[model samples]
Target chain A: MRKFIWTLVIVAVVAVFGGRAWYLHKQAEQNKDAIKIGVVVPLSGFDENMTDRIVTTLKTATEELTKKKPYKIQYLFEDGKYTVKDSISAFNKLKASNPSAYIVLGDLPAFGLRPLINETKMPTIVLVSGDSGLPAQSPYLFRMSLSSKDMIQRLASFTYNTKHISDAAIMKIKNNYGDDGSQFFKKYFADLGGKVIAEETFNVMDMDVRAQVEKVLATNPNMILVWGFGPGYTTTFNQLSELGYKGEIITDFGVFDKAVWENIHNKGDGIYFTTIDSQANKMNPQFLQNYTAKFGDKPDVVASFAYAAVEALLKTIENPKGIEAGLYELQNFETAIGKINYDKEGEPHAQIVIKQMQPDGTAKIVKE
Target chain B: MTYVLHQLIMISIYLILVYATNLVTGLGGLMTMAQAAFYGMGAYVYALVALNMPVGFVASCGISLLVAGLVAWILSKVVLRFRGETFVLATLAFQMIVFTILDNWEGVTGGSYGLSEIPRPSLFGWEVSTVPEYVLLSVIVAALITGVFWVMLNSPFGLSVRAVRDNERAAESLRISPQKQLSRAFVISSVLASLAGCLFASYVTYIDPTSFSLTESIFILCILLVGGSGNIIGPFLGVLFMILFPEGLRFLGLPDESAANLREIVYGTILIVLMYYRPNGFKGIYSVK
Candidate 1:
């Protein structure tokens, strides 16, 4: 009977406490004047692992910004889990609660929300897909993140501006992304009176490109331009080695995957590509140190890009009169990625760097 | 801005998921984790077919139905032979396979990034332009689902499905081929799932692997269980409850990240509560869809 009474008392306390907890939760939920900046990310499955580095970056952004701007930037994180429908569903849900949705950060590529965005006029600060280089019909969408076109443009311009090479060959996937990047180079280099002796295209998913690389190498160009990320890049390097083709290589940012690098470690010596950020760079000790302490590992360019996006959004919403003025400030703010800025539509104009994988299997930017 | 429009829209989506999952689990009594696979198939097929095709709304739904039904027929025969846990595992395998196609077939389905900017159905010019209008579309779909489920599940034909669910041998001994009833349930579920998929693709304006996750399948199943499986109101309440309650938590002055995690924890806790007190799942009509 004594134990029973004690148990009954414990149960009563738990029940009362639980009831109070829920009531307070409900009461707090009803409060207005709480400004919310919605966020979406691919948080599970294949994209699940991608969120670890990004989540830390997100945590840091809010914590850091609150020190300066207090609680002005309210973070509402929605998990899109790399699904386009889920991302839109998350956005729709956010809009339902906070309907006058302002500055959002997520990978809202043009193709995903193009029709809806064109209709809604919601000021989305999207981590974008295509660039201004696409066909004119890509809409009035303002991307507050770097584009593949911009990255390639900087890669081509810097390589040529510093007179890095006069003759080079290009190899890429036969897709719009690679094809568009190639056209930019073709137009820019030809105008500059430089020689792009050979240009080749391979299937997008196919990683075996020995014949393709050899055909480009057969042109006897000064450097080989490879434009595939991940496994495709690894395959090109291995094939280039097997064919014993030893000239300079210029590729896009995608080839920097660790497994891809390891796959081509022996062959990646002196191979050149371009990237927005790097994990190995201990130069910016502040971010890397914080990132290391939290995650117990180095941060990837993907994570850095995500952080830069949140940081830009923070600066935008936390300004004197909010987004419009914040966007004005964001357009010119400089960072580790260069003088980062956006046009009126919130698309970022960034100066990309060309990084070379040295003989020792580490990457270094070509300081132009 | 009251999102009565958005809530109605969500009602339509989970309504389809509920009846479809009901057909396999509620009626056919197959605890499928692969309904998400069919839903995804329906989504991708709808997007791909509608891209260059001149198919209108009903036609788009029809195509999705046929495609998903065919896939379901194949899967049901191959995987339904196993009992209980093996069946669930088979469906899980199917879900993973569909996810693989969505993520790896980048050129066709745009890979893991997915096919985006799917145009809204411009069916003969009365545009389903807004979310409210889409909500109406969803209501019609739900009505169709209710009518169809009513006819099939209440009919003697549905009894055979229920009969198979309770005891396959008993249904078989009664001259009702368990295989035949199971096949019909699979087709019906797939068609319903495909319709939802088509609507989902049209409403969301994009389709990717994320839409077809095992978690999504489980979420839909939770809707079935929480709202009391086999009842129409159960799914709606489950969906509405799941979507609104967590979002409502934003009012409290916690940091953004804490609020987000708390929302997830609350969702988990709600499930645990429903499980502990109401395992037959509140409505107790537990005979599967």
Candidate 2:
């Protein structure tokens, strides 16, 4: 009797799981007109809001692009679950979907799937990113995102050239991004004749970094390049108070999440960041208006690029011909983000922006 | 040649782990989920020592054994209560505790970025830098460990453990303390696990927390159970199946996006089928005693 009950339970569990998987497989086969572009993003994970904007912008841009074009660009969004394995799984699913090109839209964990991406022989593009440092390179991979190497060099140059900040301390998430960014900043900051007193790391999810901040405080840096992400950044200032380490907290565009500013501490004035998009840019008023009307909010760096991606794709396929025409036309198309100059590699060289936060939690571009 | 060598080294590592686990869960009436914690310790120790200290072959082996023994002693003391489900839960707590140390303790362990570019291991004026040489060393060590397990299991000490496992109350009445027997089995098992971990770390030339998780503990146990635990040749056969499943996944060659996940589904399905059809295992003694 016990054996029979156990057997029945196992069979029922298998039946349900098997049913769901089969339905998904069948759905893919039915969508014949759709050209599924696999989009691995962090929609429900730590970078949820950012990915939400990016995915939405991409969808909207695709619709707009399709209306202006002969063929429709269909995207299949896959949440990476904020993990390397899931990213690989998403890549595998895209390959299994028999898509034209599986896109590594955002999320640095996408590097973990580089080997599988390379094996697919399909073109893959990355947006503005910090490195996770898993795979060094792949033929199929093309990243227009400012590489860690480039970002650090530019940061060092900017820091040394400026007379405002003399001494800089470093605090980063204790991952590949932090490791590379820290090392890069350390080497270049010193090479550029800048003094870096201390380099420390905090767990990206750690709400309290008072211990590490105390040591960095003891160094008495004039400013701190406090590299962090997600909710961790909001807690950073709190940890600063506990440690009594008050200095300028400098960060990058990646940490400019909506959740960061929604909190009180993150809303503080004079918090400087180097990002790409300007929410109040008079030049791209149409973009700002349209994005706000649709998304009900201002788009961040990822949303702008993701929005640009769909815009680029639609404009590429403007004519009724084929992929060749789309490819050729995209070479000349302009996006609100910047010019879309896609090589055979599909890399778009876009301009990045630097913005500073106001006391009211709004970031205005620090005009050079 | 390198590929062949890699497989041999992999086989050796699995061999030691399987035997170690088999001794605990197979011969003794106790289950453990903290094997991966011990494995992680060995890897981290080797990574730190290789980077910082003068570590020779003997030194590496000694350190691995010492770390395992210490972890086992501490764990056994804490988890000796509640033998069935609670015991499983306790070891799970141990696994989580170890993971916390690895993930949160970044300053010392390098956290999630992992310790990379580990120095190649050398022994007695002979360095096994290449794949084939490492394979030879791994296989020789594996064979010796297996031989020791083989002898130990056949000894009177092994008989007492099995007696206690089969009937704990009866064995206790006969003067064999269940606690002491289980603890001894656990320590020996941990040593074997840690030794394999040391070799794995040295071979990969890196150590990370991701490599050792509670999932890994389940995987090692699956090998022994799927091959029919408690009897001779069970753990060995189980190890073969475990490696073969992944290699089979490689052959499917699904698309980039679906290949990895589909392979995982397939792997899980195989385990499920095996458990259903052959609960005693793929190669258990069929005597209806």
Candidate 3:
């Protein structure tokens, strides 16, 4: 009798957990006609406000697509909390909720997720930019955000081909994004016949860039490349001006915000940044206007990236071949961020525009 | 399901960490926060050894054990000189120093980008690659560590450690060397933490500075305190509550925008209530003063 009771208890335990799993799987199956997109972002942490805008854009994109398309679309957003562990946890929960998602949208560094992505074979679109090494590690992973390597390469090419700078110096943050960018810039710039005279690094939370700036200034290079994000990106440029260096300064789209320039008293004249053409508010005027009216602020780069990722995912699902048809199949696809294409490795093949901040604190497109 | 197996693997790792922390903080009466540092040290040591050396995963684990144990011994010798708050401060300082080294030491530790492409653990030509296989390995490792800890707890050394915890002066009066007992406990706990780290690195196949940050140490401490760790089973209970509480919030039907914060608030509230009502924990033998 005791043995029979033990067997019953074991069976009951399995039935409870197994029933929950079956219910979840059944719910997922009911929405077979809908294309499910799982989004993971820092919704309640350091980048919460910025992520709110992205979420808003995601909602608007989905709503607009649902109104136009015959099939319904579903989205599940989870908080990554700006950490790799939390991101993985969020991804797991999202995956459990929908076992057969078309694609997952994530906005964290992709170092920790590569192994899992390789194992699961789930096509994920990464928003955070850096040295993902995705092409070599996991082919199913697609980087929707602009690549830091590509940004540096474009900056290097522009410096060599257009500015005719033979010598350069780089100031980067002492993290993966900066390290990868610095390495890529040096190699690409050197291969393009330019010499990097000096390279220095600063921590992300560091307020003091004077020592690094001074070290780079001592090199007396014709051009300077700065790799950083947030307000600190402008700090390198300000410190350079304070030291009276007159070299052309280059950075990524992280410094494209006019608010960043306004924060600095010096205005850091002659500093340029690489950005997508969508920042000009030339494409998708209706969507931009709607976003501005809704949020009282224009949709920034974060929103643009979110919109483009959703657009790409929607298009890929419509292909009937899914993401496996290869992101390259969406050749010259017109996205919210203008004409965009992808190479065989899922990297966007698009135009990178350079914008320079004028002495008056206004930025104008310099190179397209 | 793979999801359940994944959660189980994570729980096993946390269980090991919580058990190690309990050995020192719960029984040895030391408020040390350097477990995360030892854990990261073991992971980095394993990753570097496995990748650079021609040694297999077992050899890498052995090297990690030796490296982490030695470092823990050296750290205990230096920090155990102080008692109470000063000792806690020393551990905090050591934690910060370790974190800084891990973040800045790009040459060996891979800096903040983290070490990736870590090969999966293989046991005697059997590759533990699949989720179920890794889960089984995790359970076995956790069980082995627990078994070793259980044996030690039933021995005279465990009684000495607890005696030192109850009253160091009394233990000394009873001819027990308080310093020796404390140091032994600290070293044992730190080595076990390193073992847990090796399992973590092998299972996750990647790690970063953030994983071994001060936040993680505090989280492990929460597992001990909230679980009311004074006995062997206390750490298991603590690990279960801490791991499952936050995860349980996923089913609350909360919006994504508020889910993370709400989960923290709920988890914190439950812990506070538990500490107030049941300070000795559910199955703990002693209450934290």
Interface RMSD of each: 6.1, 9.0, 4.5
**DockQ, candidate 1, vs. native dimer:** 0.20
Model 2 docking grade: incorrect
Candidate 2 backbone clash number = 10
- For model 2, residues A1-368, the per-residue Cα lDDT tens digits are 99999999999977866776677678656666776677776545466566656666666656654554544566776645555434654555556567665556443445555545654566555665666343245555555455565566666666667535657998887666777788888888888788888888887678777878888888898778867576666677567755665567667765456666666343356766776553335224555667789766777667766666555554434446543335434654566566656555434445655677786666787664
Off by over 4 Å in 2: A1-30, A105-108, A132-136, A241-245, A264-267, A278-295, A311-333, A339-349, B1-33, B38-208, B211-289
lDDT per residue as tens, model 1, B49-105: 888687776677678789898888887788878868888888889888887777668
Which numbered prediction scores highest in TM-score against the true structure?
3
lDDT of model number 1: 0.67
What would the TM-score be for candidate 2 when compared with the true structure? 0.63
lDDT of candidates 1 onward, in order: 0.67, 0.69, 0.78
lDDT of 1 by residue, A1-368 (tens): 99999999999967866776787678547535456655666544433444556666666655654565545445466655444544555666566556333333334334455555556655455552444432232333445445666766666776676656778788866544555667677777766667788988775446688778778878888776677443565677788888888777777655555556667877887777777753345224565678778766566565666566666666655576655456555656755455577665555676667788877656787887
For model 3 the local lDDT of residue B113 reads 77
**lDDT, candidate 2, B1-289, per-residue tens:** 3333555677788888888887878887567788788788787877777777776756876886898798798778878756877888998899888977886688878876667656667888889787678888889988998788888887877878888878889989999888888888888888888888888777766566766878788878778778876766877788878865664554443443454456667888988998889887888542111
Docking class of 3: acceptable
lDDT computed for candidate 3: 0.78
**Model 2, C-alpha of A190: deviation from truth (Å):** 0.8
